[model samples]
Target: MKRDFAVIGLGRFGGSICRELSMEGMEVLAIDIDEDKVNEFKNIASHAVIADSTDEATLKDLGIKNIDHVIVAIGDNIQASILTTVVLTDFNIKKITVKAQNDYHEKILNKIGADQVVHPERDMGKRIAHNIISNNILDYLELSDDHSIVEVKVGAKMLGKSLIDLDIRANYGCNVVAIKQGKDINVSPSAEDKLKEDDILIVIGADKDISRFEKHLVVDE
Candidate 1:
């Protein structure tokens, strides 16, 4: 079956998601308390509606139950964000993603049943900062509280080393997700594949583990 998504709130965060999903060919329903915001997303998302998302009855009337996933992106309004997420859960929507304003908001969303809580602004800032801090790292993404995904250039130190010989997962607590060779990426790489000096690896693990793995890429005299 095809997947459908619903976006509640048309702020920058929500607006970007709605537009991206629409562009990716998913059927998306956009919602907001502001008519202008809804109109702004018109002709982009498959559907757009102006409604108060804090009202469970209103969400139900909008057929939120049929949505495969619902995104709660209400900006700065913790009450509305929580209420919307709870209501979506009550309706038994398959998946729910909420944007939290801060740690407290994220905790509340987590305890109240959001399948995923995103801190877009904070995460973007962290990524930018981390990229600036490291030479090998191209990017980083927090997969969970304990785990992250990182991309790093596989330099001379790691070149010609087989994954089994290096034992990355065992030694560094990280796993190579993919290898980027020039323009192509090899996903689900075999353990015996050798890392070339120029290869870029997409790895996943705990934040600390990634730091250790990045150290492994450094060349010694």
Candidate 2:
């Protein structure tokens, strides 16, 4: 089934979401107060309109109630972001995700009933920082405040060690969810499978445990 999505605010973050959803063959209504921004997405989105999302009447006129998910990605305008979210909540949208500018914005969004709040810039910074800190860490994803999933390249310490020999779950408190070699991925890697150089391990665990696992196994001394 093709899900219906509405993305308000046509800034970089919102624009990116609109593009991705449309590319995935979902029905998307791209909304923005800017005429040029609306025009830019006219060919990409299922529908694009220059409408103020903070106005309840305008949203109702756009048939926003039919959208399965709404993303409020208003850039910098905290007032508009909060007001739009409040209006969406009043309409009982099934899922409302908001882009938070800061911690205070996130708190308000959560209190106002936003289902999910994302910090794109902050998250990208963290990913880049992780990539820079270690040559082995290829990517990082934050699952919660204290938990994360990371992609770590199989380093010298991990080379030739089988999953049983490492006993990662018992020793490091982490799980090897998958392993990637070249372009192929083993989603269910066996316990006897041995690690090879340049292979990537997708590990998930609490932040401290992941750090410990990385320092002891993935990172070179």
Best-performing candidate as measured by TM-score: 2
**Which residue pairs clash in candidate 1?**
none
**Least accurate stretch of 10 residues (summed lDDT) in model 2?**
212-221
User: Per-residue CA lDDT of candidate 1, range 103-217, in tens?
Assistant: 9999999998999999999899978877776666788898888788888877667779888878888998888889898999989787898888778888888889887777665
For each candidate in turn, give its C-alpha RMSD to the true structure in angstroms.
Answer: 2.7, 1.3
Total clashes in model 2, counting residue pairs 3 or more apart in sequence or in different chains: 0
Candidate 2 structure quality by residue, lDDT tens digits, 1-221:
88999999999999999999999999999999999999999999999999989899999999999999999999999999999999999999999999999999999999999999999999999899888878999999999999999999988888999989999999999999999999999999988978999789999999999989987887788
Query: How do all models score by TM-score?
Result: 0.85, 0.95
- Cα error of candidate 2 at position 148, Å: 0.8
Full-model lDDT, candidate 1 = 0.87
lDDT of 2 at 75: 96
How well does candidate 2 score on lDDT at residue 145?
Answer: 91
Error of 2 at 207 (Å): 0.4
